[model samples]
Target: MTDPVRVVLVDDHVLFRTGLEVVLGADPRVEVVGQAADGVAAVEVARAARPDIVILDLRLPGCSGLECCRRIRDELPDTQVLVLTASDAEDDLVAALRAGAGGYLVKDGDPAELVEAVLGLREGRSIVPPDLAARALTDLARFDRQAAAGPIGQLTPREREVLALVALGLRNREIAARLFIAENTAKNHVQRVLTKLGMSSRAEAAAFAVRAGLLSPS
Candidate 1:
């Protein structure tokens, strides 16, 4: 049998965090491994617990949830992050994605949807509310086009192929499998692609690909 998904819950509100814990814990498929009430503590707990996913909040007290997301993702690349917050602002969603969060969900959604988002992250999918997703793509595409093109034109043909797949939201492991390469090799390719493109996150890389006409929105 598969192991339950280990999760670290982070939010400043005790009642909300506790309620989510109970809600998510009721699901046998998920295990609440750790909890934090602030961004700094969230990072520490995540580092120590090394859970499968970190459920974060944007308006964290010690630091912005976006900062914590970046730290957790940068320090623990194997652990994915999902932002669960009350803020539905487009800037917040875009920032969270750009900070390397695997998914974003507003607090207004049903608890069942939260469970589904957690499971979706386990399956290597990015989750966002339907209401925000379309506008997000349009805004992301615009952001990419307006940003100065870095060394993107310097990428080799193979690297371009990888970037296109990234734009399609393919993770490194999936990219490796599709291209018949080692996962580590795929990871290296992705890192190099980001370096050459002067982008910090896969979300940005996808936008860059779209702006470059290497990928279509459809």
Candidate 2:
């Protein structure tokens, strides 16, 4: 049998966190391995637990959820994060995605969908609410053409290929499989692509690719 997806729940509300714990724990497909009430504890718990997914809130204490997401992702590339919060602002969504969060969901969604999100992130999929997704892309599309073109030109043919895939929302493992290269090689290519492009997150790269005509919006 396959192993249950390990998850760490992070939120400032004790009642909400406990409720999510009960909701997720009832499903055998997931195992809630740890819980944290603030950003600092969130990172520490994630480092110690090394769960398949870190589900957190945006308005966290000590540090913003975006910072925690970045730190955890930087330190543990294999561990994905899902932002579970009440905020549905386009700015927040874009920021979380730029921080390398694998998924973002508003608090009003069904509890079952939250479970599905955890499982999906475990399987290497990016998740965002349908209603807000288009708006986020539009927000990202506002960069000046000169800014986009200069960095786009700096990429090698291979790095460009990697960039295009990242624009298509392919994770490193998926990109490695598609390009017939080692996962670490794909990771390096992605990092180089990001650095050469002067981008912080894959969302920026994806938006740039679309603006550059390397990828079409879905």
For each candidate in turn, give its C-alpha RMSD to the true structure in angstroms: 2.8, 2.9
Which residue runs does candidate 1 get wrong by more than 4 Å?
A: 141-149, 171-188, 198-201
Measured by TM-score, how close is model 2 to the native structure? 0.82
After TM-score superposition, what is the CA distance of residue 160 in candidate 1 from its true location, in Å? 2.3
lDDT of each: 0.84, 0.86
TM-score of each: 0.81, 0.82
Candidate 1 per-residue lDDT, tens place, 17-85, comes to 899999999999999999999999999999999999999999899999989998998899889899998
Clashing pairs in 1: none
User: How many steric clashes does model 2 contain?
Assistant: 0
Q: What is the Cα root-mean-square deviation between model 1 and the actual structure?
A: 2.8
56, model 2: CA deviation in Å?
Answer: 0.7
